[model samples]
Target: MTRRVFLSIMTAAGVSLLAAMLLILGMLQSAYTQRYRQQLRDEAAYAAAGLETGGTAFLAALPAGSGRITLIGADGTVLYDSIGTQDMENHSGRQEVQQALASGTGESSRYSATMGERTYNYALRLEDGRVLRVSAADFTLPEVLRSLAKPLLLIAVIVVLLSLFLALKLTRSIVRPINQLDPEHPDKAEIYPELSPLLDRLSSQSGQIDEQIRELRRKQQEFAAITENMQEGFLILDRDTNLLSYNTSALRLLGADDAVLGQSVLGLNSGSSFRDAVERSIAGEHYQRTMHHDGRYYQLIANPVHQEDGIIGAVLIILDVTEKDQRENQRREFTANVSHELKTPLTSISGFAEIIMSGLARPEDITHFATNIYAEAQRLITLVGDIIKLSQMDENSIPVEKEPVDLREIADFACERLSQAAAKKHITMAVHGSRETVSGVHQILEEMVLNLCDNAIKYNVEGGRVDITVSRDPRGAVFLSVADTGIGIPQSDRERVFERFYRVDKSHSKEIGGTGLGLSIVKHGAAYHGATLSLESELDKGTVITMTF
Candidate 1:
């Protein structure tokens, strides 16, 4: 800014000085030329008067350095030349001589290129028929300038030096106030009045910029808070796949440390599929893939961040899909198990009926075959009913209406219904404890108790006992506990006992004549009623399953 101002001042000064010099030189040249012409006229008139008074001898008497003098005859012939010898050209064609012959006097000027001068001529018509002319040659404008060149250059140098000094001083004066102005408080600075408007605008813009910066910071903090607390892993990467931002969940899911930040995303997981997905997203394509990290499944979704120019970066979202995948796998397994379970009883019933219809059975075997067919059909009905109940519970389509159901009554009813089965196994079943009423669907509660008691009877040893207890814990929560002296479950298999179609003893499951879905039904029913189920068991001892609501 200082240099610019200095240059501007110098330029203006240069132009003004040049203009002044030209104007002065032009005026001086004009005045000098006019005076030279007038002197020529006066010389001619004086010489003419002397020639008329003292004859031709008067020209010889004229002083030296008076200028050139020529006398012409009336016949257009140069008769006398004051400064030269004989032969001379006629002056008839000369403008001044011709005009003087026609009128009383004439004046003209002509430049001589060869002599580098301009001649001013004045011709006077004397009383005689002859004409007298006086001419003086002086340097032309170009010659005049050449003669004054040295001094003019010296003067220009002085003027330029002076101008440079003034320009520097003026530039500093102009720029000093601006430089001293406080950017933070432009309005408070003492500055040039001419710059007041600029200062005011700067102050306003500074405030606006401060406000904008604060707003940007606030939004950044808000965004950080939201992403940091998110359950899903979130990551932001630049076009080059460098990690720009990431949440803690992202680090955990990717199994990476803080060093991964600012590094390539490949540092977290260098798998080809992960790299390919990131590359595709940076190329403006949305991509997704399932990645296995640390034995957990993650759904990795990469979406391009776009601007008017094109894709600038990418956002990667990693969702934990371990549970979801497990559920899907379970559903497929359950479908297959249902098909197999339903088919077995159906095939048995079909075969038994076919034998009876074809009369392959003798009269003595008819009752036995018919009875087996009825039992298989009844088993099929029970399997189908359990499947339907499970399906309803899984879909959350169970009746929402609830009533106060006594746990003791449910236990007693289950024992009564399963008494014949318990007697067949030589198992004694009893219900104890006070009536504990829990708010739940009565049908679901009844099914839960019935399944528990039935499972105890089916899995029990000969002459085993089943105890159903309904009571409250210190927390004042209603609880129902079913303990059975049965072939106790192993610790490892106990966790999976509630899974559909899961069985501890798959070999004797057929001999037991019980669907493996009883515990699963009880689990689903307890979950629907917002109750927590716990199991305590030891091998060769007994299994105790409790539901607390």
Candidate 2:
């Protein structure tokens, strides 16, 4: 700031000085040129009057020293030459002389080879028909100008040097006061009023700053210790690739085992969920995600951070959620299983009561009752089997084991299992696909497919078409899609279709012996295999249940 102020002052002063100098030079040159021209004209007018008063004898030189003098006759002939001998031609053609003859006064400029410059000429024609012309060659004004040049140049140099010296002194003086100010109390700064003060606050502040720096260093060490001792991982980073700071817990959870200060978070872990979390946070998303590593699950909460300046960084707090997450997952599965267990029995009891109310007597009545009981029992067994399978998935991290089960064969078997039930409902079922070799627990996947096919047959209208399409999606993800042209589920119930104990038509589902846990089991199975479950349907139209694994 001081340098800038000084430079500005110097620039203004220099510009004013330069403009004044030019004005002075211009005025002086004008005054001198005018005086020189007037003097020469006066001399020519006086010399001409003398010639008019005396004749040829008056032109004869009585003067000791003067400029060139020439006299011409009335008929354009040179009468006399005082300065030098030269060819006498027509005086009427001479510019100055011709002008004097034409207008009674004349002036001209001519190249003087002797002076190597242009010289001024003046003339006056007398009443006696004689023309008198005078001219001077030397430029005395320029020599005076040359003398002023040296002085002006010297003044300019002195100004620049003095300005530089003053700028340095002022810069240093201002810097001392600035250095004295404490950053913490900068709003109320103190500066020395005197050129030299007893306090010398800059020196004092420097010492105090040194002490404060040591204190800050100690505080930083304590902060680091606190963060290290904290069980929850803490990570802070800017919007840039540079990671700011991380605690030991963060390093333990993530691959950044050591300090990642000033390092790129991207380079530390390539295939990590942390990278995704960071990207989302940088995009201004505040979210939490669970990541599992080495038999432990970490809940990472990515929150955006800001300072006085605005959004500059993000802080990610990581907490171990392995135990709680496992418990919650177990609870969800258990609840589903319990619901499934209760549903099948309830359906059986309701079906039995309905059959009892109907008045078919003896063997026919007994056969109908026995069939209904068997159907309920089979549904219960299927529900229990699904519950056991889902429980096994939560008890371990490794999948329930994979085998090359031709999905074609499984689909065939599922169809066979559900074929009898579909015939009872008078609903048609079919299986269609290409390659059917996939890796998954056969019993679980079989149940999932069978449940979907079973639901299609059960909910389907009498004689309604049940089309099972087994295929792979665009990403080569294998899918089992069971589409039915039946009284489809409503849009509002679509989201809860896979939820435990959730049914589209409550009364009708009981009548058809629905476990109400089939879709829930399907959902859990798909989740364990990292698969996606979805359904598209509209009321009174149709339904498509797809499971992609």
Candidate 3:
């Protein structure tokens, strides 16, 4: 700024000096030209007087370099010439001579081809009816200015030096107080009066800036607090792909540190999909991708930030949706499993009925085929009912009418209901323990106990015993546990026992005559009652599922 101001001052001085010099030169040339012309007129009048008194002799008596003198006859013949050359042209057609002959005096200036210089001519009419003309080769404006070049150059150099010195001095004088001004209090500084308005504006702007900075800092802190604690990872990037903002969640998920800030985002994780998404977003396109990082799933979304010119930057939002994605996948698999399960029984029933209708079966086999068809139809009905129950539980669509439910009553009722099935399997079923009461939905509690007991008997060893225990522990918690000597769940399948349609023994599932939804139903019911369900099992030994309320 200082240098620019200095140069501007110097340039203005130079232009002013040049303009003044040109003006002075022009006026001097004009004045000198006027005086020179008048001098020529006076010299011509004096020679004309001399000529009238001394004739041709008086003309010869003039000084040597007095300039060319011509005396012309009344008939337009040059009779006397100061240079004494007879080769002179007739003066009758000359502008000054014609004017002198008509009006006694005339003057003009033109270049003389003979003298090879520009001349100012003055002609006076003599009393003898002849013209006396005096001409001198004088300097033209261009020639006069050329002759003054050395002096003018010296003057310009002096002016330039002076201008340079003043430019530096004045520049310092103008800028010193400004440089000394305290930015914190511009208005109170000692400065020129002409700069008061600027100082006042600066002071007002400084206050506003401080206020805005405080507000910005507050907002930034608030934003950091909110984003840093969020479960979802968040990130912001500049147009150059540098990390602008991020949170703790993002750093943990990306396996980065605070040092990664202001570094290229591509350096943090150079996955091809992430890079592609960033590129697309920077080009003004919205992009998203699902990435697997650190054994967890992340949904990365990139959205372009736009302005009037084009895309300026982008925003990247990373959401840790591992649980949500798992649930969605489970839902899809469940749907598929349901379809396959329902289709199997329906296909069997349809085939049997078609065989009967077409008379393809023998008469002796008709009853057996009819019984098989009926059993398959019943299996279909049971599968449909279980699906509806699971769906309702998932949607929480069943309204609960809560009450204190007696676990002993629910257990006894479940045992009695499964007695025939237990007897068919040669398994002994008994309810052993005092009554335990829990706050729950009655229907759901009964269903939970029945499913647990029924599963125990269905998957039990032939002649194995199924026991139901209901009691309160020392912690004042009511719990119901069903233990069975059955084909126990494998270690790998134990955790998945409560998941719908997840059967440990898929090959023998049909022979087991179970829908595989009983334990899943028990789990949902127990959860709805704020109960904790646990499983202890060993292959070929037994399994115990306990629900503590």
Report lDDT (Cα) of residue 310, candidate 2.
Answer: 68
lDDT per residue as tens, model 1, 1-549: 556765776688778977987887888788987887777778888888889889889988888888778888877798887766465666788898889989978778887443356777788888877888887786367766888899888987876787678778888888899889888889898987899999989999999998999999999999999999998999899999998998898888877776466778878877776788889999999899998877889998999999998888999999999999999999999989989998998898899889989989899998998898898889888888899898888888976688898888888899999999999878999999998898888998898898898888888899999999999989898889999998899989988999999999888888876778999999999888889999999888789999999
The weakest ten consecutive residues by lDDT in model 2 span 194-203
Location of the lowest summed lDDT over 10 successive residues in candidate 1 = 111-120
Residue lDDT tens for model 3, 1-549: 556765786688778877887788788888988887788788888888888788889999999878789998777899998876568778898888999999998878899887788888888888879998888887576786688889878977886677677777888898899899999889789998999999999999999999999999999999999998897778788888888888888777767765467888887777787788788998889999998888888888999888898777888888888989988998998888889898899899999999999999999999999999999989989888888877777787777778988999999999899899898989999999998888888988888888898888878899999999999989999879999999898888888888889888888888887788888999888777789999999888899999999
Best by TM-score: 1
Compared with the true structure, what per-residue lDDT tens digits does model 2 show for residues 1-549? 756866886898789997886787778767877888898888887887777677657767547466677777767787787754466557677788778888988888878664467788788878876778777763455666677788878887888788878888888887877677665554356666662443455556767997999999999999899999998988888888578887877777665657748877776556467787888887778978888777888887887776675678788888999879866985796686577666757777677767676753465677777777776677777677666665676564445567776777778888888888888878888889976677777877888888888888777788888887778768877877889987898878887787766778877665676666788778887887678888888666678988776
lDDT accuracy of residue 31 in candidate 2: 86
What are the lDDT figures for the candidates, one per model? 0.86, 0.76, 0.86
Error of 2 at 178 (Å): 11
Evaluate residue 106 in candidate 1 and report its C-alpha lDDT on the 0 to 100 scale. Answer: 78
Give each model a TM-score: 0.67, 0.39, 0.60
Q: Which residue runs of candidate 2 sit more than 4 Å off their true CA positions?
A: 1-382, 396-400
In model 1, how large is the Cα lDDT of residue 460? 86
